[model samples]
Target: MVGVLAAAVAVLAVVTGLNLVLLFAVIRKLRTTEARLGTAPVATLPKQGSEIGSFLIAAEDDSMISDASIGDGMTVACVMPGCAPCKTQIAAFRERPRSAPEKTVFFVFGGQGEPETEELVTSLAGLGQVAVTQTAGAVGVALDDVTSFPTLLRTEGGRIAAVGRTWEDIGAVAVATVR
Candidate 1:
């Protein structure tokens, strides 16, 4: 009986050691992925009054969203189709005042072939223009140095004026820019 008890203890120890090793491996992998995502430093983005760099606007036609097109100012929202926060942000953006539709633009991450992409475009069309592009090299993401979803930027006179992560931030910028 004593020998059997010792064997069980040895098996438990071995299993525990293996679990620890696997856990550490998973933690290391997660850290690597996080580092690669290039999430921007907290609240330090779109430096106020900085000129935005040029980036291609994904569209069916040969058009681009540039500072030239938005002469006065515009509100740009960055969204990922499958992201929960993005969905919430979209809904909030859609509910913005009626006068804001013309001044808004949505930069949707990922290609336009998916059904969700189509739905997103149709929904946002009512609010403003939609530009679909992959996460890499996307104009809004690149210009704003965004590392997370639902980043909104307000521009005035071809320069960034405000940056935010929530609908309230967007509203505040909108009101501020108008004045």
Candidate 2:
């Protein structure tokens, strides 16, 4: 009876060890699979990059401008509303060469709800900058890998030059770019 009890304890210890080993193997496999999928478990915003494509967006003026219609020689700054930094950048942008005929920075407002989005437009308009309407679909296309709000994309010479989630001294950056 004593020998049987000792053998039973040894078997239980081995089973526990095997279970731990299996758990580690399964975890390692899941990590490897995630790596292959080109996506992290956590969401990350996209970094500054070039234009993936040009597409037209609707606006309050009842007009439309397709991405292809944008002149290659011009630099377009597509902006969204309700972004405090965006408002400051827009204010500073108006004073920069970006407003010059050659640069042509276009404001594009995109938000989740119509009322909130309209409020953004009103706020920007009050600041004296004309903004176009960016539908939810267009916003999705414009922002690639953007996980949060307040997105600013700079397109120069027909390609995306830089993009950021915030302004962080954007006036200096804008001035430096056009000058």
Candidate 3:
């Protein structure tokens, strides 16, 4: 009985050591990711009447933002794969009114070479235009300094009229900003 007890204690110790190593590894990875994301303070986001810089649409043929198929005004949605909140945001976008598609542009960041990215692009293609970019920072620089995921921007007459985090907010802004 004593020998069996000793064996069980040894096994428990080994398992505990393994878990500790894994926990430390995860912590290190999290810190590294945080550092890479930077600590820049979030700026006061653009509101109505803010003119935004143009961003390119990384299409099969590569087109400028000005040449997009949008009408009257445009809605730019920033998204990234592997983000849970972004999935919810996508669902909200999908539930938007049918007329919303024509004015919508989905900027897919970190989607290059991922199978899930391809699937998302394919799915959103029917709803609106999709631009698969390498990084969110690049898109932000082009679209009035956006730095976060799931950002929705509504533009009218080539200027930002509203910014939101959900589809409801965007729809409300669209209604109020009619030219």
- Specify the highest-lDDT model's number: 1
- In model 2, the runs with Cα more than 4 Å from the true position are 1-49, 73-81, 94-97, 101-113, 126-136, 142-149, 165-179
Best by TM-score: 1
Q: Can you give the TM-score per candidate against the true fold?
A: 0.63, 0.49, 0.61
lDDT tens readout by residue for model 3, 1-179: 99999999999999999999999999999899889977765635546566666555665235545433433467778777776877887775555432355567787776577898877677676556677877645567766666567777777766777777776666633222232
Model 3 — which ten-residue stretch has the worst lDDT? Answer: 170-179
For model 1, the superposed segments whose C-alpha errors exceed 4 Å read 1-45, 58-63, 173-179
lDDT of 2 by residue, 1-179 (tens): 99999999999999999999999999999999988986745534445455645456654545555555454434444556566665676666555444344335355556535676676566544322344644446544654534444455555555555555543322224344433
Task: List residue ranges in candidate 3 displaced over 4 A.
Answer: 1-48, 60-64, 67-71, 136-138, 172-179
Give the clashing pairs for model 1: none
What local lDDT score does residue 173 receive in model 1, on the 0 to 100 scale? 31
Q: How many pairs collide in each candidate, listed in order?
A: 0, 5, 0
* Model 2 quality (TM-score): 0.49
Error of 3 at 40 (Å): 8.8
